[model samples]
Target chain A: MSLALSLAPLAYVACPECDLLLNPVVPEPGDKAYCPRCGYLLQRPRKRSIERTLALSLTGLILIVPANLLPMVGIKIFGNSQDGNLWTGVSALFKEDMWAVAVLVLLSSVLLPLVNLGLAFLIGFHLFMHKANNQLARWMHWYEHLNEWAMLEVYALGIIVACVKLAGMAELRFGLGLFAFIGLLIVNAMLSNELDCYFFWQRIAQLTKK
Target chain B: MLKKPLKTAFMQGFIRCHDCGSLLKSDPKCLCPVCGHHVSARKPNSVQYTLALIISALCLYIPANIFPIMSVTQLGVAETHTIVGGIVALIQSDMVPIALLVLIASILVPLMKLLGLSLLLLCVHYRWQVNARLFTRLYRVIAFVGRWSMLDIFMISILVALVDLRGVAQVIAGPAATAFAGVVVLTMLAAKSFDPRLIWDHQLSYE
Candidate 1:
């Protein structure tokens, strides 16, 4: 309930890698702390962590609309032009009875990134305003776990692979959505990089505990 | 079995919550104060789950490569392509860079992950006295590259969606697409279930 209580507790840190208990290094903003025993990245406290995460997640949220809904690429084959949007890929898999891959694509490419961005935005927005939300801790927990599954960058590469494979068969045209999808990928990458777990957890623990 | 080290948190009555990274009293039944998630000293059945998943992926590895991933029909002619076949076609068509990309993502990465996790499992099972640090590095690499294997599955999905002009040209998912997706997911889970701490434990002298 005091001002100093907002700081992260540094009693000890167990490396997620080797579980070697050591005195936690309280890195300054923009500095990183690494595990002494197993070289796991212990912490990286970035400057303006909350604000930057909020901005990037907001940008990603906006881009998601155009990225997934609009046609990402158009193919011209023998005077026949067909456009492929993100949803069509999942639906196409389902049509071919590849439901497993369909769900995987849906979960990893579309749904998980949406969840990650939404959770991050919620967490970041509330934290920036210094507002108390009971769900902040839960949001942060899921955010960390689901971050790995949000594979926008990998899907971007998949888009590249798809274009490469089809280039000889058809004339490929880059659509506005492809650029927006790339923007979303870049924003998500930046947001993931900018996230400071130790700082956010400390802030949440401080906010909710009182 | 190696003697438990006194320096680590597990032996010193502190269990870090994997979810929120909070250091707490070492109790198997306690939920994390911040996240309300179970706190464990290590991933339960780490070696067994990793070994089982890796073996399962290896089994799927065969069908994933042999079965055609996609069948493309253009102008009343149909040709099926397995993963290797697709890469070879790409190479023959002077697309070596894309061929290499597919070769790496579809075949090499999964093979490396399966082998690396198996070696780590063997190391922990035998308590192999080797450089724990290097093995830990290997574990990190396996974990990082696990997601990229999905590159092929996503490509097929896009191809299936983009090339749907009936009779003129169409690409339909083959049986291998499902199995290939399985290999990627299982290997990722295998890597996740493994505890790198087990590697460092072998460095401790037997009591």
Candidate 2:
């Protein structure tokens, strides 16, 4: 526990879920503090969370290209073959004038995830390099709100469901993009676990205190 | 009381950053000194906003299920599949496990969302002195499972994108795709807008 954090009754923490007030405690490194009333995770002390999250976010960014552009799955029937990548789904929907659905798919599956990773990268980069400006807060705030809308893991499940449905109808082929996507999903999952938002907010406040 | 010395931070004159969870002294001009985002005692009109979104989602749920979600065209024949129709097709083909997954993800999850949110809204509206803690957990469950409803939409997109061997066998998204997506998105928004804290306020009042 840092001296700053140990002075707790001065800054009572409220549970976001259930409105329970608590005196802040310094959880052991990588341990969580949950609301006694509703079990909402108050915060956790992640060890070097910024560095790890930055690496995962960068990995996610690198995986995004192949995950979106390359075929995740292919099907063959009666001597004919067709393969689908993440982009093709949205484009195909657009071609059929299902533009609203296409746009939703594109945003949730592609653009929003990119925004999240990009913002995280930017914030982490600035923080690590000791370069904090007025814009860091805005970016961090945006990142918090936009994080929920990025559904890469859900999209990955959708891919698996799609493959299963097609299994009996034709010969199914797994593509490299599928592996890349799984990697991205793992990265995303770990990124969330490694993230300690309270820590980030404290760090940002310290840097941008000017 | 859920714990000893029961009180909320807001009651203690602390306004937490809604986005970052930083506690700031609650003032007339409440803003998180750390993140500079507005921090309210509670989300204003949370129940009303949640109710509105849930009502709209219930309305869209009809078209989402009524119309064909996608059509598989093969050998000059087109077979359109509604959500239920897809499950039946799968069952007839003896893919019980995948059939059950779709039935749950596409059908049951959305239904649960609509009904669950409505009940939670009712509880908050009435300020019923029911078990707030349980309902809070229910809210968490609903929020967690809500995203899985996108399973069918995604599957359709992939099918439409992948099975395009023209005149041999191709899949195309149908009219219901938009409605289904709307239902999922609206329910998610509703869940996001809801304040679970309200569920406990009444409990605290009774104490």
lDDT of 1 by residue, B1-207 (tens): 112233778879999888788899888888888777888888888998998999999999999988999999989899999999999999999999988999999999999998899899999999998777778889999999999999988888889999999999999999999999999999999998999988877676422
TM-scores for all predictions:
0.95, 0.94
The sequence of per-residue lDDT tens digits that candidate 2 reaches over residues A77-175 is 897888888899999999999999999999989999999999988988887787878888899989888888888888887887788888878999999
Q: Candidate 2 - CAPRI tier?
A: medium
Query: Any runs in candidate 2 off by more than 4 Å, and if so which?
Result: A1-10, B1-4, B204-207
What residue pairs are clashing in model 1? Answer: none
> Which ten contiguous residues of candidate 2 chain B have the minimum total lDDT?
B1-10
Q: lDDT score, residue A175, model 2?
A: 92
lDDT of 2: 0.84
* Most lDDT-accurate candidate: 1
Instruction: Report the lDDT tens digits of candidate 1 across residue range A14-131.
Output: 8888888888666676667777656788887787888899999999999999999889999999999989888999999998788998999999999999999999999999998989
Q: Per-residue lDDT of B1-207 in model 2, one digit per residue for the tens?
A: 123535877777777777777777777657777677777878877888998899899999999999999999988799999999999999998889888999999999999999999889889888888877789889999998988888888888898888888887889999999999999999999999999988887774523
Candidate 2, residue A173: Cα displacement in angstroms equals 1.7
What's the i-RMS for candidate 1 in angstroms?
4.8
